[model samples]
Target: MESVRLNNGVEMPLVGLGTFKVRGYEAVYLVLDAALRHGYRSFDTASVYQNEADVGRVLKELLPKHGLSRTDVFITSKLAPRDHGAGAEAGCLRSLEALDCQYLDLYLVHWPGKQGCKSEDPGNPGWRQQSWEAMEGLYGSGRFRALGVSNYTEGHLRELLAKCRVKPAVLQVEYHPFLVQSQLLAFCRASGIHLQAYSSLGTGCLVAEPTVAGLAHSYGRTPAQVLLRWALQQGIGVIPKSTHPERIAQNAQLFDFHLAEEDMQALSGLHSDTRYCWDPRHVV
Candidate 1:
């Protein structure tokens, strides 16, 4: 798999397995096993996902069976907003315990919470600044190899940068053919921050879109592949999730093809500024 080097010189996989809305120990084990067998070493999970223990259990058991160690895989987790303030550090520690790992390869603020919730709670408090301070402390402790935020707008990032001594190493967001987020991408590149794209397949909402269908047919690939390649060409890390073994394998087979400059522009032109995740306004 290809890799992106962070400002601190840590190497992160350009493609990873995203575990969102995936539940139950049995289900997580099935997907995690498939992902690992399909050459996926980077795994993204969060406390809110409620599958950390299952994921950790599977990894601990499977790695030994495959002759792999914790150091051989890149594990990432997020700090939930409800755990902000004095509870933030403790929350991360709990996640570490659940994941059965000594340190995380990456840790992110799940969202810039208003009070502490990312959805429809405008009155949530002490989320942004408090969570950031906790993350900074985690970074200083050397427990997390890298620190970042997910679903943060430019304004959110600006606020953190102004107060954070250790600038975020990454900014994860919903990005795809329909929402390119060009300005944020440019700003992140300029600031030496790695930008990761979630919902890179347009959240499966593009399956019926004529534009994506046409492009997929032309390339003789799935729509998912087309969208993922587009994001990679833009130098953004992508974590596309799938439970089907074949689809999981297909998502990783992107390095063999290159999208032409014209095709790239065509995909970019399809952008409608669409977002498939939670609203940042409610969070921040």
Candidate 2:
């Protein structure tokens, strides 16, 4: 697997297994098993995803089964919105316990806004900043190899950057040919913050797009591969998930091909500001 170095110098795989709606321990076990079998070294999950323990259990057992160890795998989990305020450190501890790991490879603020703040208004003073402040301490403690944020818009990132004691190492956001956020991507790149793409396959809706289909046809690859490759080609990390062993194996085959410049331009033109998942821009 190809790797990108985080700002802190930790090596992260370019491709990762994202568990969003993937449910149940058995299902997670199956998918994770398949992923490891196919050379996947990174996995993404969250407390809100409800399968952290399941993923943790499988990792504890399966890595050794596959002749790998915790040091060999890169695991990422996020903080829940509800845990945004005073509960941030406790939340990190919960995730640490749930994942059964001494530390996390990467931990992120799941959203730009806070929840259950004392003011009950994220826009109110001291609410939104609370989350990042708490996370900054945890990051300083060395419990997380790197710290980042998810679903953050340019404004959100800008605010965080202005006050942050430790600069965010990454910004994981939803991106695909049809709904790419190019400006946000450029900001992160220019700032030396690694950008990661979630929902890269458009939550499985981009497969039917004529542009993507044409690209897939020309590349002789699946639509999914086209989307994943597009994100990778732009130097953005991607976490595309699948449960089927064949699909899991297929997703890992991204290292062998390249997308041409004009083809990339065509895909870039498909961006419509169409978001397929949760939008955090209005959270304040």
Candidate 3:
């Protein structure tokens, strides 16, 4: 698998398995087992995903079967919104215990505000900062290899940068051809933060788009591969999820092909500011 070095100098695979709605023991096990067998070295999960324990158990049982160890793969989990302030450290510890690992390869603030709090809540900023401090402490203790945030906007990042003791190393967001965040991407690039794309397939909706289909036809590749390659070509790490064994193996086939510049432009042209996930810009 191709990897990128984060600001903290940790190597992270560009492609990983995303377990967002993927739950239960059998489901996680089957998908993770397929991913491991197909050369995926990273797995992304979160407290809100509600399957940390299932993921941990599956990995523990599957790693040895594939002749791998804990150090061989990267595991990333996020701090829940409910854990935004004083609950940060404990939430992180819960992930560690649930994943059955000594430390996490990467940990992120899942949202910019506390759960159940309004987006413009006056306390959001303070809560988020407090969470970062807690995360920094975890980083200091070597429990978190690197710290970052997900679903953060440029404003959210700027605010964090202004007061953070440790800079965020990665920013994961919902990025795809139809929702290109040019300014946010540029900011992250300038700030030395690696941009990781989740929902790269537009939550599986992009695969059926006519333009994407045409591009897939021209490239003789699956639409999913076309979409994932668009992100990989831009130096962004992507986590594409699928339960099918064939699709799991197919998504990993991205390393062999490169998207042409014009083709990339074509993909970029599809950007319409359409978002299939939560919008965090309003979170103060």
Candidate 4:
């Protein structure tokens, strides 16, 4: 798989397997096995996903079978919303323990606010700062190869940039043709923070969209592949989730083809500011 070098000099795979709702030993095992066989070298999970142990255990078993080791693949996990502020360190530690790894290749602050707090809660910024401090400590200690934030808008990122001792290396967000996030992308590019796309298929809605289907037909690719290739063409990393073995294999077939410039623009024209995942815009 292709990779992009982070601001901190760590390389992150352009494509990764997202384990959002994937759970259970057998399920994770089967999906991961198929992913490994199909050339996926990056795996994304989070504390709240409740499947870190399953992913870790399954990887430990599968890596040898694939003739690979821990360092051969990039592992990313996030700190949960409930673990914001003073709980940050413990949260990262728990993820490490659960994944049974010495360190995470990328560790992200999953959201901008605490779990139960209101979206505009005045205390949110302070909590975010506190969390970043602890995360920086972990990064300095080598527990995290890189530090990042997810679902942060430009405002949130500017706030962090103003006070952070160590800059964020990546920002993962819900990005697809419908939710293009062009301004945010420009800002991240200027600030040297790599933008990664989660929910690249717009929670599976875009896969069935007329525009996407038309393009998929023209390219002789699945709707999912067309959608993923759109993001990859722009240098954004993507973690598309799937439990079906054939779909998992098909999703990794993105690197073999490139979309024409006009076709890329056509996909970008579908932007309607639509978001199918959690909206963190109102989080103070």
Candidate 4 per-residue lDDT over residues 216-238, each given as its tens digit: 99999999999999999999999
Candidate 3 per-residue lDDT over residues 1-284, each given as its tens digit: 99999998999999999999999999999999999999999999999999999999999999999999999999999999999888888998999999999999999999999999898899999999999999999899999999999999999999999999999999999999999999999999999999999999998899999989999999999999999999999999999999999999999999888888999999999999999999888888
lDDT at 2 for candidate 4?
94
Displacement of residue 151 (Cα, Å) in model 1 is: 0.5
Model 2 CA lDDT for position 215:
89
- Model 2 segments beyond 4 Å from truth? 116-125
Query: Pairs clashing in candidate 4?
Result: none
Residue 233 lDDT, candidate 1, scale 0-100: 94
Question: How badly does each model clash, as a count of residue pairs?
Answer: 3, 0, 0, 0
For residue 103, give model 3's deviation from the true position in Å. 0.3
TM-score of every model versus the real structure: 0.94, 0.96, 0.99, 0.99
| C-alpha RMSD values across all candidates | 2.0, 1.8, 0.7, 0.6
Identify the superior model by lDDT, candidate 1 or candidate 2.
2
Higher-TM-score candidate of 1 and 4: 4
- Backbone clash pairs for candidate 2 read none
> What are the lDDT figures for the candidates, one per model?
0.85, 0.88, 0.95, 0.96
In TM-score terms, candidate 1 sits at 0.94
lDDT comparison, 1 vs 4, better candidate: 4
Winning model by lDDT: 4
Error of 3 at 94 (Å): 0.9
Whose lDDT is higher: candidate 1's or candidate 3's?
3
Error of 4 at 181 (Å): 0.3
**Candidate 3, superposed: residue stretches over 4 Å from native:** none
